[model samples]
Target: MTAPVTASRGRVPASATAGRGPLGGASLPTWLAAAAAGMCAAAGWLRVLPGTRMALLLALAATAPLLLAAASRLLRRTASTRDTRPDGGPRPPTAPPPAPAPVSRSVPASTPVLMPVPLTLGLSLAVAAPVAAAGFWGSPARFAQAAAAAVDGWAHLLATTVPAGPAPLLATGPFLLVWVAAAITGELLARTTRAAWAVVTPAAVVFAASCALAGGTAYAVTAAAAFTLGGVLLLRARARDLRGPVPVATRPARVARVARAGAAAVAALAVAAVVVPHLPARPRVDPRDHVTVPDTPLTGVNPLDRVSPWLSTPDTELFRVTGDGPLPQRLALVALDAYDGRTWTSTARYRPAGSGVPHAPSGGRRLTVEVTVAGLGGVALPAVERPVRLDGPATLAVDPDTGLLLDTGGLAPGLRYTMTSLLPAPPQPADVDAAPRDPAPATALPPGVPAEIDALARTAIGGETRPGAQARLLAAHLWARVRNDPGSAPGHGYGRLAAVAATGVGGAEQIAALYAVAARGLGLPVRLIVGFTVPEGANGLVRSGDVAVWPQVRLGGLGWVSFGPTAQAAPGWQAAPAPTAAPLPSTPPRVVPGAGVPTPGDRLASDGPLPVRRPDWPLIALIAAAVLATAWLSPRVGRAVRRRRRRSRPVPADRIAAAFQEVVDTAARAGSPVAASATVRQALDRVDTAIDRRRPPDNDFAPRQADLHVLRELTERAVYGARPLTTAEADDAWARADRLRRRLRRPAPLRRRRP
Candidate 1:
């Protein structure tokens, strides 16, 4: 009571389906299986995709199969309704058959015509849970944001930091194409083929690529294999339901086909396992390295070099800090002493400084500052004046002279560090004169110093002999003229001369650099300090706007003392008394020397020794050959082991079935007439006929043919005889079958055997 069979056709006709409802509608399980396959494939991509945008990827992947299924159903319905009569008129309709009488017994209520919404939602949630968990584990906040913008965040949230390469589209293009094809192809193939293996092909390919690209981790490979097995099981079950039952005569052939399919699948996985590990790992570039330069002149630590678009966003919290008492007005990032005419950077060597905390100055107090960084992104760790001790997960390196923190890594979000520093005392005239002798390197000027800069310095100092007096005069002069406006700042090409020519109209960076350069031009030691200024408010919310810069001049005994030269100079610096003549320089001031070389112990430590590598071609070849050989032979070995296991089973009929299957598979592989649709009797006859048809048959072929015929009879008896098959008889049949198989595989005689 089934639709007409098409010989050797693997699948049941659509009209003879078992699980379909009375109206021939698609079954719910079929739909769910397809959706699950798509969902698992999407989940597999989580291990390879770069960002916390799993919600969007999963939503797209899960819905694709459903959409394809709906489209397929619509196309089938349209095809069924179409009239195919050659004439321009519709064919005449036949009389309808009589309706069957209804039974009195109760039946289950019919499902609605529409797809089940709750079931679909439940399946989607099930698929989305693992992806969500993974995203949360990696980055909770970013994942939440991506989920919130699932409908429209693809462009902004789903991206890697790597730049577009030669084939930019290949990265995402192949993944999407494979996803859509898998959904549509799997749905169509499910109906045309008995097994759903074809439906999962695209998904398998994608999963393999993902594993290879993700460095072939054990977890990734295992997950992909498990999902593939699940898809195979689901497909096989649906195919079985559609096909109904297998006849006893054909069971042996079916088992052989299943074995072949399994071997093929195992071979594919073995090959992937052997090859994927040797593939190169993916490379990614950090987006933070490509900072743009500002259009206007810069001063403090070359502030324009660190300018970022994110910092310009209003109301964004940058960082937060807490200290024991009042915080210093400024927190230095680094001190720049080497000016390259165009920019200022640290070029001095650094030595290891101990972590032990240092005592505060005579009148200053010791306090600890805890900093919690937010949106800022840089390698520098900002701390109060003269950090003595740092405590954090990251290793800390400091410049002994400037006390600037060395670059460790990017300042990631949510980073917290504690710094213990000494509060620096306000600069005083007596303190400046009491400082030790200043180093000549601090006053060295770059080559080709413009006459305009020299004239401006000479005019600002006006014959002042004291170091502190000259510094104050130049600072006040620059502060009076600079407006801190971009339009009024000097343009590029002339260095500090341009700023002096423009009447010092620039921002903190330009003015600070102007003061440092002018002080150095007058044979005074000075350096630039770039840092953040603490506002009067105690909220402790530091925004990008709070960034500032100033100059620190070297004194006789007090060391380097800070002085603000911008229009926004702190009140303390402006109120400091002018330098006195008491502790004058050991010798009179000299003319500015050419830029001096940076001595050792000025910056961060040097890199360690690199490791050596030598490639061994012979060893590499041997390893590759071993992997390839194992992958190639694994399936055959597995098939042999399975056959041996079946032979040892207690059931006699199972042994007969396994032995007979081996004969049919071997004959088919040898290109003999052992058709899959043939019965056991027909297959035996075909084997005999094939032996006779061979030109000059082997001398032992006649005896092998007789043995094969006897074994076939035993197999038929075991399958259909009234009496049960005995263990002794099954063993005898197995022995004869193995002998005949070996003879059939033997080489034919070349001559008439010495006739």
Candidate 2:
């Protein structure tokens, strides 16, 4: 009773008769999948973007895919409409047949129209740019910088710790990541039937990346739910689109769809309940932790150098502290952990910090102190031994292991910040075995340390097997042996420390540095802490006179415990009185030869003075300069070598391409950078644009434009042409490229200036 249906190729077919659903328009589930990808990333970025901002951004991100999909659909329809002819061009019309012989005819499937890549990407940029500007820059003036950040902010984020604040620079990374994921996923789903295999798969990879970059907050349950819904919805939508519209679907097809949906729901429930929770058993290693911040010139003016100046300018107010809950008697600026026998420096790994610091292993009494800088300047923000939280306007960076805070925006006068820190308990006799030995700069013995210094350190510890007792005995020994001369010459080099150990006469600067070196020699982890001491009977005004350089030993369960070398100051030098309101329990001013603390009875022998070896000044200076020069030129040298190899490549075609790359690289170094992925012709065009922007009209300085044209043609031929290149042709290409490079390297003729 049914007429036979046949498929053929001729007249334009209707939507119901064509297989255009899957390859043409995006179904509802595809849209959901694209949207869910963005939400997954956004959910992870909750800490970076607050409630209202995050909601607004999410709305924009979700809407962008829809807008993009609509544009794509419209573009495809417009393109299809423009093609008026059939596959064989315009054909003559034929008369219809009788109704009794009613036959259904199907046309051969036509290739689905696709939105041009340029248009699709252009639309995506148009949609994402405004959101990036509004969300990250928030100001027209900063839009350009924000754009640059969008390109590379993710890299910067990798170097910073978690919750690295809501700064525009860091937030741009997450914003761009989510936006790009949505755009790509939307485009794929809209154009292809690979919903589960292709579209959702890419989104899942990006989701993993989002989770990695996101701060340490648990959103697994919510993200899992979104993934479940999105995956199921996307798959079902793709299946329906492949089968065409639901209302027209056959009874069997409808049953299949319902059955598939039910199965997917059940699977999702099972996985969500049983699988997601147990994934990734091992602790996740943060990518940010692997990133190291390069050393800057800040090391030159570190707090160690300020010791002498602060001591000399005794009465100058450094900062004033006002707080409750037993404020620390001492405040440290930085922990000096790296010693190179010449001088001690902190291997300060500064990264953008948030309000809360990750907790340290040891526990202590928590106290909150607020500080107002009077004359204290530079990057150091003095805080308690182990700061747990920082609340202030100043941008901060912290060393999580040491709990040392650094002010990225240099500390200036009147800068105020509140730091809540845990005051480590005073050194106890049982600490010898409790403290874990650090396997790094903390207890590392730097190269070139004089042998006598280690022997001297061993002498100070004196067969005390227990590390805590040994540390106490050593500190007490240093106090008894060394006289705290405030006017003593300042330096913590091996020579200075060795002399201090031998002569038994040193000020706080030498003693603290010497103690650190000695402890490292004894294999005990330590830090040379530089800060001001708060003395009793004095108000909160901490002066430069209170500058104390002391050593802190890491005990087993107690964090860094301050082991001061008790007072042995000269008669004339006395510590200023501090407020007795909230005395720091048990600990006292002992490192600076402060006049309050009692000296220990332990004293080590200094029977024979160790000879001080003067470092070779000129030789050392030359070596340092050479090392610096080498560091600067290494990259350039490596580039030259690479270019040489490229020019000498075995294949002539490769040589031609390499020649072009060398020129691009040189141009980029000169600040006119072209992307590595750009085609040769495109790169050359951009280079031309850069020159045109800068070149003056009627300027007599002529450039070889003809050479550039020939180079571009040769490069395009080498990369895309069918013909293989000859060695002679490759040589000639390199010759022209070298000329262009030299021309670029030469400073352009100075534009004649009129007085």
Candidate 3:
């Protein structure tokens, strides 16, 4: 009936299977997609500048599978491909295949799945790990540390800033992620059918991760163009293969279909281009923020509590500073910012200090000082603020938020280190009106703060609205009115602070604490610092005599600026700042000798509090959503596999039987299940009645009554008739069953009736 099928009717053979290996062959389109995916994933290394040698190694990792697949295809030719006549041109035609023998059972054994390299695929991926590891390490000799390097890379990436290093350990994370994804995608391309669609998934995951960690914004356009080209090529190739031989008469229709698909894809990309650029930019949610490190060495220890003890033992040398230039004016041991009615503690969050030294605000002179511990029994190290670098004898941890340093391994006696610090420029006379309040509510007193202290703070600040001016007025008022008696007992608690505020007489520790609490009342955020002030013409030695506590008020732009409340001649609103400021105010020139210049504002707005950072909660939510989606879709995946197995049977009798089973299953899922024990005719009757009851007469539910009846008759003949099922009858049955599956999958469930 159909004109004898041949290669010459402007029609190609469905498959030149004789030329393909038994396992299958990778389509040219799949190869392009896998390679493109590998290249995109490899680009992720740009974030941390993984070196040149690593790039060559990664290229090898990406290409190895392609090379191996090509070799396998070349070496293992099918026997049919070699068969030819003595003329050396072509093989002669053979007789048609004989009809299949009649089958007693309704179904035969299932055919093999489209992909056939389970064992080989595992071996391929196993080989991929070390290859990727070698690529990351950049040397064959260093493979031993590959696994450890992968783990270390996570910490290294999070601890160090962008463009961290070309270090081997740091390159492992991106290498393993890209290489493993590429290897898996390669396997899918090498031996599969429509499964080629899955080739993009693994590579896409790696590509997305790379995009997330990329250092610059240039990834979007270039990567999109590359991926789009590969994806289009793959779609075009697979569509051609799925269509098998194209008949001349159907060529125009096929072109129309392809044009529609291409148009749809282009439209989707156009809509995305139009929409994405206009969307609001969201903060990058780095899992790095959630990485946990060792707690600070002085976690709960309040350095302010040590103030009275140090002053009591005035001559005890805690540490010594020697330098290449002029010595530092003072060294701050600790800044205690959090007070919860009782104890004041530093917000010390220590992580391994990799490269970034946190923040160093403008206006500072660089100075290098070497500090060597002497009798500094406490864990806190005496160091300058805004340290740029440290080269030391101890393992150090630094708080990226506070620029606070800690010796994780313990600050033993005689421990030595050199530090680079930014010493702030002197305060200007006009600074009083320039600075604004940056009150950290966390530092202010809670509901438990006494009323009289709050009232005194208001009185001290008076009519001064400017933050810097209010701070100066408050400090001057304390120095003039409060009497510092060294004999005053050592508590700086709420009761002790209130006692000192009322009596106007207390040790320096109590006065400093009172200053902190009172400053909070004037709407100025404050913290207490315990440190030694270097005296004029001082030698290298720093003693407990210099251990005085002072209050620092945080201003909007200038950060924590220290005021000298203990200086005896600190006149009200007259003495503006520390000793290094311009010409002195109207007050007497009795400024404390060798008082430090204003400490540089190290805590930038970003470094102030974790709340200021947009929390990466959406990442956690995405993880949860992925888990739920996986659980929900798992059964669907299993059903798809089963459906493929049922639909792909090669034997005519088996195909007919599987077709009937599929129709019954589809009916069951659609809420009109037929009884398992029912006869073939009975099952068809029930299915027919259910379909008629649910589907509207004019609607698009496929397999009209006549087609379903014909499928039922064919199924009956395969299962119960004497003759073997024919290929024509089997095709008709499967076509109708698939149409039914489509019709049933839509539409919400109705009143479910049990079988």
Candidate 4:
């Protein structure tokens, strides 16, 4: 006969177990982890500076869910305790009485996973929506605006290119999604022992790699370290929550063991991260010229057409020239004879400038400009207006109508050519008027000519009939009406000039185009030429900033004469660059410029061919020495780390298990290869097997065998049996395990697997 059971010595009431959910009481860690993930993701918003307001908003968005979870946890804990006592006071202890009969109370099983899936998803969506809305809608107040307009605005936000402005505000949506997904996945995986890697591994790799690729080196290293620390904390917390049902008396050892293992793994990963940057790069053939030169089509849209886009890169080396005589301030890429008010194109049929040398006035000096295509490439070679010679390995044709050079096959990087042009000699005023009348094609105006442009031209010229004087008057008008701004380049020359006339501001290119259009309106054969300008005093290095566009007028005797509409230089003969640096070496190696961003070295290394780089033997030797040293010390360092981390556990039994497990893992990493699923007995057997295979001396192995047996028995009892291990017993076990590990280390070389 059994007495009625009492709660004191029996199974706990059902209420104690009712709190279980799919996350299994792991809400605290889950929310914290989610917040951490969100913040890390937000750090990649854009390369630009995000102000203090944006940073605060990002922090609040990430932390809101965590704070809610914490508040809810506190409320539930308070509610649970409310039923235990009247004023939440602890129950008073009384004198011990005879123990009651043991009895069991039925507890309802935990809620099924099916319900929590939607709950978790709902919670995650609830958290993500506000963040997404903030990112898509920009400001919270904008929702009150027209619904249709708001929807269109949101669509536009999504379509915005990467690295767009408003920074963290634009990035919050993606960050929230990644965080919720990773945290939820981690929570689910946490239910199983050793399964946290399923979440941590992919997250770590993705975030770390993204930081490394998109951010600078310092940012990447910091991100990697932060990720490691966060992941370890999240994993440890989730693991602790899972062990909630285990007996408190025996839980410490297990927790400590897992904690030590996690620490060691993270330590090894962090060390590897630091070492990787120092490793010698693999040898490969160097990449040479692979320039993507923007083509100027037959329509004759000048380089000004690309100012809005192409001008972003100010350092790109376009070309390098070596000349027998003075180099011109500008080189014409192509000329347009037809203008439609907004743009220009050449409708005139291309004719050979000459079967041999093009005719130039008798008094001009013959000079040659040898150009190397350091970075430029296109169908047309940028040259002076009248090129009499095209000397290179390419077949080129000249458009006598416009004096534009065209290639049969497109030009490429490394292309070398020499252009011999008879430098322009100012003609006598009578000779210009006596020469053949300016061609009608050059002076023709587009349809619907703006009245204001014609009126302005007439007002500036003030009844001047001479073509040269008209050009000069128009140049003076352009310089006064339009201001030169190096920062802005207009896409449409004529439109830009019209705007400048009204707005009183324009870039050099726009001002030049204004003069061309106004001059043409007044019946002068004027056109726009786009090319580089050597500074008033230059050292032969032509930067992208040197590119300029200005007007040129065709006179009766003089070919196109540069009209200084923008005050780029004095109007005579477009003076040559003053000599500074010596000519480049005869033989230069092929230069591989930094991708997209041009460096100073993009300039020609030589006047001849590219130069070859010599290898650095000293750096190579230093790296090799470091590698050997790392290899020699690795095992010793690993052992010391393991020992220190193992002893970090406060519980005696836990310390013993941690020390033994460290050996098992180290042996596995060092090629013993024990599966996580292996039982204590099975793992010991593997250790014995590895020891036997490596060192097979029967008499000398007795002490190590004894230690191994003691460690195996003690660990099995500590982990699988109900008996609690005493402190003395735990210490003895640790000593034996440590001895066995030392013996394992002393044996023949262990092949370490790559991390």
TM-scores, each model vs. reference: 0.41, 0.58, 0.53, 0.41
Q: Can you write out model 4's per-residue Cα lDDT over 481-578, one digit (the tens) per residue?
A: 55556555465545565667777566666666677788888778766666665443454555565666656666653455555556343212232221
RMSD in angstroms, candidate 4?
Answer: 20.5
List per-prediction Cα lDDT, in the order shown.
0.52, 0.62, 0.61, 0.52
Better of 1 and 3 by TM-score: 3
Residue pairs with colliding backbones in model 3 are: 314-545
Instruction: Work out candidate 1's RMSD over C-alphas.
Output: 17.7
lDDT per residue (tens digit) for residues 1-755 in model 2: 11111101121212333224433445665566557655655565664444566557755765576567756665665665454466857655657733222111222234345658668766776667766777767764556776788767776666555555666776775666666667777777666553456766655765677566553424555665676566656666665554333322123434654775476556546544543343333334566667765423234387888877777777788888888765567777877877777777887666666665653323456788899988888887787766666777736677766667767778789988887775544433443334454344478776777766777777877777766666766776776667777788888888888888888777777887888888877878777777777755556788877777777766553445566564524345563322111112335533444444443211110111112345556655655575567556655765665676677777887777777767776777666775422445556666565445444354423545776777877776765567888999899889888877775565544561110
In terms of TM-score, the best-performing candidate is 2
Residues 123-160, model 3: lDDT tens digits: 66566657655565555556567767766777666765
Who wins the lDDT comparison?
2
| Residue 644 of model 2, lDDT score | 66
Q: What's the residue-level lDDT of 697 in candidate 4? A: 67
lDDT of 2 at 664: 76
2 against 3, candidate with superior lDDT: 2
